[model samples]
Target: MAALAREELALHKLHTAEHYVSKAGLRETTDQIMEAISGVKAAVDNMTLRVDRIVENQAKLRTTRS
Candidate 1:
């Protein structure tokens, strides 16, 4: 009976440790995904600014031609 109790306690501790390790891994993954998303958003914003500048320049050229 004492051996069985000791085994059960060890199993419970192992499971708890595994749970925390899994959560830590999940948190790291989530952080990496968020960083990637931020990078993409920055790229898109930069592209938008470039397009706006092109459109403005085109408009200026049209007015000058008229």
Candidate 2:
């Protein structure tokens, strides 16, 4: 009857709210993971540049000695 309909409506609303909350949590986690990946990429780029400079300097020293 009417009481049963009301209960069903309430349950539907609760499920909808839970779904949104779960989606929001997943979005936040994805954002955090992307930020971490960006930070690691920046660090790797910095290390590569430093290594290249070191190698170039060593080559110059070898040429001067010869």
Off by over 4 Å in 2: 1-21
Candidate 2 at 30: error in angstroms? Answer: 0.7
Report the alpha-carbon TM-score of model 2 versus the true structure: 0.67
lDDT of 1 by residue, 1-66 (tens): 999999999999999987766768889999999999999999999999999999999999999999
Tens digits of lDDT, candidate 2, 4-63: 999999999999987766768889999999999999999999999999999999999999
How many pairs in model 2 have backbone atoms within 3 A of each other, for residues 3 or more apart or on separate chains, i.e. clashes?
A: 0
Error of 1 at 3 (Å): 9.9
Evaluate model 2: give its lDDT: 0.95
Q: Count the backbone clashes (under 3 Å) in each candidate.
A: 0, 0
RMSD of each: 3.1, 3.3
